[model samples]
Target: MYVVVLIVVVVVVVVVVVVVVVVVVVVVIVVHVVAAAVVVVVVVVVGVVVVVVVVVVVVVVVVVVVVVVVVVVLVVVVVVSAAAVVVLVVLVVVVVVVVVVVVVVVVLVVVVVVAAAAVSSPCDHASSSSSSSSSSSSSSSSSSFSSSSTSSSSFFLSFSFFFFFSSSLISPPFSSSSYQSVLIVVVVVVVVVVVVVVVVVVVVIVVVVVEVVVVVVVVVVAVVVLVVASVIVASVIVAAVVVVVVAVVVVVVVVVVVVVVVVVIVVLVVVVAVVVVVLVNFEAFNANYKIYALAF
Candidate 1:
C-alpha cells in the first residue's frame, strides 16, 4: 500500500509538474506572440506615420515653392509694368511741356514783332512829313528871295520855334531820325528775342531737372515698395513653413504618445493575465499537495 501510494503521489507530482511547465510555456508563448504583435503593430503604425509625415512635408514644401515662384513672377511683372508706366508718363510730360513752351515762345515772338512794327509806323510817318515840309519851305524861300526877305525871316523863326517845341515834346533819342527809329526798333526786337530764348532755355532746363527728380523719386519709391513687399512675402513664407513643421512635430508627438499608451496598456494587461494564471495554478498545486499529505 505504501509503495502504491508513493507511486501514485509521484505520478500526481509528475503530472502537476508537467501541467505547470505546460502552462508556463503557454504563457510565455502567448507573451511572445503578444509582444511580436505589438512590435508589428508599432512598426506598421510608425511606417505609415512616417510616410504620411514625409508626404505632407513634401507637399507643403512643393506648395511653398510654387507660391514663392508665383509671387516672384508677379512682383517682377508688377515692377516692370510700373517702371514702363513711369517712363511713359515722364516722356509724355516732357513732350507736353516742350510743346507748350514752344507754343508760348512762338506767340510771344509774334506779339513782340507786331508791337515793334506798330511803334515804328508812327515814327516813319512823322519823319516823312517833316522832310516834305522842309523841301516846300526851301523852295518857297528861294522863289521869294527878293520879293519876301521879311516873309522868309518870319517863316524861318516860326519853323525854328515849331522844331524846338516838337523836340521838347518827343524824346531826343527817338526824335533823331527815321533811320535811328528803325535801328532802335531792331535793337529792341533783338533784345526781346534774346530774352525770350534765354527764358525758354532756362524753363527747359528747370523742367528737365524736375522731370529727372521726379523719375528718381518714383524709382526710389518703387524700389522701397518692392523691398518691403519681398520682406513681407519672405516672412510669410517662413512663417508658413514653420507652422507646417510645428504641426508635423505635434502630430508625431501625439502619435508617439498614443502608441506608448497602447503599449503600456498591453503590457499591463499581459502582466495581469500572467499573475491571475500563476495564482490559479498555485492554488491548484496547494490543493493537490494537501490531498497528498492526507493520503500519506
Candidate 2:
C-alpha cells in the first residue's frame, strides 16, 4: 500500500509540474507579443525622429550659408592666400586641402545616400533576390541540416537579407558600445579645443591691450592738445629721444621702426587667427600627437 501511495504521489507531482510549465509558456508568449508591439511602436517613432532631424539639418545648412556670406568670404580668402604660400615649402600646410576634403566628403555622403535610397535599392532588390535566396538556404542548411531531411523552404529561409540590411542601417548606431566611446572621445576633444582656443584668445587680447597702452603713453608725449598735453607729450618724446635716438642719423632708423609697427600688428592678428583656428579645429592636437609619437 505504501509503494502504491508513493507512485500516486509521484504521478501527481508530474502533472502539477507539467501544468506549471504550460502556464509559464503561455505567459512567456503573451509577454513576447506585447514586447513585439512596443518594439514596432518604438521603431516608428525613431523613423519619424530621423526624418525630422534630416529636415532640420537641411534648413540649418541653408540658413547658415545665407547668413555667413561676407565673413565666410573674408576668412576663406585670407586663409586660402596664407595657405597657398607654403612657409619654406618644407611645411606642407594642407589646410585648404583638408577643408576641401571635409566639405567634399560631407557632400558625397549626402549625395550617395540620396542616390542609393532613391535610385539603386529597388533595382538591386529585384536583381539580387535569387543570389540572396541561395545564400540564405545554404547557410540555413549548414546550421540545421542534421535536424531534418524534410524542412519547409520558408523555415530554411526564415531570415530576409532585406530586413537584415534595414536593421544594419542603424544597428551600429543603436546597439554599439564603440559608438559611445567615439562620441565621448570626440566631445572631450571638442571641449579641450574650445578651452584652449579661449585661453589663446585671452592671451592675445592681453598682449594687444598692453601694446595699445604703451602706444597711448607714447602718443601723450607728441600731442598738442591745449599745452598741458604738450608738456606731457614733450617730456615723453624727450625720454624716447634720449633712450632710442643718440645721433641725428638714428632718427631715420626710429622712423622706420615706427613705420613697421603697423605691419607687426597685422602679423600679430594673423598669428592670433591661426592659433584660434588650429586650437578650435583640433589640428594642433594632431600635430602635437605626431610630434610626441616621433619623440617616443
Candidate 3:
C-alpha cells in the first residue's frame, strides 16, 4: 500500500511539473510574437513619417526657389529698361544742345562779317568823294561836283533809312536788298533743321517709352496671373489686382509727365533760337547803320 501511494504521488507531481513547463513555454512564445509585431509596427510608422517630412521639405524648398527666381528676373528687367531710357534721353538732350550752340555760333560769325563789309564799303565811297573834290581846280567844276555828291549822298541816306525801317517791320533786320534773299534762306534752313531734329528726338522717345511700358505691363500681368493661378486664396488675387492697377496708373502718369517735359523743352528751344537770331540781326543792323551815318 505505501509503494502504491508513493508511485501515485510521483506521477501526480511529474504531471504537474510537465503542465507548468508547457504553460511557461507557451507564454514565452506568445510574448516573443507580440514583441516582434510591435517592433514591425513601430518601424513602419517611423518610415511613413520620415517620407512625409522629406516630401514636405522638398516641396517648400521648390516653391521658395521659384518665387525668388521670378522676383529677381522681374527686378533685373525693370532696372535695365529704366537705365536705357535715361541714357537715351540724356543723349538726345546733349545732341540738341550741341546743335543749337553750333547754329548760334555760325549766325554770329555771319553777322560780324556782313557788318564789317558794310562799314568798309561806306568808308571807301567817302574817300573817293573826298579825292574827287580835292582834284577839282575850277570853281564851276567844284560846284557841280559838290552838288552831285550832295544829291547822291542824300539819296543813299534816304534809301538806307527806308531799308532799315522796312527790314525792322517786315523781316527783323535783314532787308538790305543785296543780302535779304541770303539771310531769309539761312533763317529758313536753320528753322527747318531744328524742327527736324526735335521731331526725330520726340519720335524716338515715344517709341522707346511705349516699348518699355508695354514690356513692363506684360511682365507684371504675367506675374500676377501666375501668382493667382498658383494660389487659390481670395486675398492674394485681390492684392494682385490692386498691384496691377497701381502699376498701370503709374505708367500713365510717367508717360504724361514725359510728354509734357518734351513739349516744354521743344518750346523753350524754339524761343531761345528765335531770340538769338533776332538779337544778332538787330546788333548787326545797328552797327551798320551807325557806320553809314558817320561816313555820310
Candidate 4:
C-alpha cells in the first residue's frame, strides 16, 4: 500500500511537473510570439513614419527653397522697379520744373517784347516799320516757346503718373524677414520629426531586448523547475522502494522463526511418550515372576 501510494505520489508529481513545464513553455512561446509581433508592428510603424517624415521633409525643403528663391527674385524685381520708379519720378519732377521755369521765362520775355512794342511810337515810318517787324518776330518766337514748354510739361506729368501707377501695381507687400521665418520654422519641424523618430527607434530596441531577456529567463526557470521536480520524484521513488524492501525482509524473518519453534516442540513430546511405555512394561514383567515362584 505504501509503495502504491508512493508510486501514485510520484506519478502525480511527475504529471504536475510535466504539466507545469508544458504550461511554462507554452506561455513563454506565446509571450515571445506576442513580443515579436509587437516589435514587428512597432518597426513597421516607425519605418512608415520615417519614410513619410523624410518624404514630407524633402517636399517641404524643396517647396521652401523654391518659395524663398521665388520671393527673393520677386523682391529684387520689386525693389529695382520701385527704385526705377522713384528715379523716374524725380526725373519727371525735374523736367516739369524745368518746363515750368522755361514757360515762365518765355512769358517774361513776351511781356518785355510787348512792353517794348507798346512803348515805341508810330510817328517815324521807317522806325515804325522796323519796330513792327521786330515785335512780330519776338511774338512768333514767344508763341513757339510757350507751345513747346506746355507740351513738355504735359508729357512729364503723364509719364510720372504712369510710373506711380505701375509702381503701386508691381510691388509686393510682404517683408524678407517673413520668408526667413517661414524657412526657419520648416527646418525646426524637420529636426523635431527626426528627433522623434530616433526616440521611437530607441524605445523599440529597448522594448525588444527586454522582452527577449524576459522570455529567456522564463524558459530557463521552467527548465530548472522541471529538473528539480524530476530529482524529487526520483528520490521519493527510491525511498518508497527501500521501505517496501525492508517490510518484505521483516515478514520473511518472522516466518522462519515460527517454523523452527514448531519442530522443536513436536520432538520433545515424542521422546516423553516412549519413556512412559518402557517403564509400564518393566513393572508387568516383575509381577508375573513372583506369581510363578509362589505356585512352585
Q: Compute each candidate's TM-score over C-alphas.
A: 0.29, 0.25, 0.44, 0.24
Report lDDT (CA) for all predictions: 0.41, 0.36, 0.49, 0.38
Which candidate, 1 or 4, has the higher TM-score? 1
Tens digits of per-residue lDDT, candidate 4, 82-171, equal 443354344334434443443354345334433333323222343445445555565667877656655655555555545434432332
- Candidate ranking (TM-score, best to worst): 3, 1, 2, 4
lDDT of 4 at 208: 33
How does residue 194 of candidate 3 score in lDDT?
Answer: 59
Which candidate, 2 or 3, would have the higher TM-score against the true structure?
3
Query: What range of 10 consecutive residues in model 3 has the weakest lDDT sum?
Result: 1-10
Model 4: residues >4 Å from true position, as ranges?
1-54, 122-296
Cα RMSD (angstroms) for every candidate in the order listed? 53.9, 36.5, 39.4, 65.6
Clashing pairs in 4: none
Better of 3 and 4 by TM-score: 3
Q: What is candidate 4's CA lDDT for residue 197? A: 29
Give the higher-lDDT candidate: 2 or 3.
Answer: 3
lDDT per residue (tens digit) for residues 1-296 in model 1: 22123223323332333233233323332332333233233333333344456576754454355445434533543454345345435544553454355445544543443445455555555555655565567665665553454454455556555554454233221223432433343344334333433343343334333433333343333333333433334333433443444344334434543453344345434533443454355446546755776699
How many clashing pairs in candidate 4? 0
What's the lDDT for residue 71 in model 2? Answer: 35
Candidate number that wins on TM-score, 1 or 2: 1
Give the top-scoring candidate (lDDT). 3
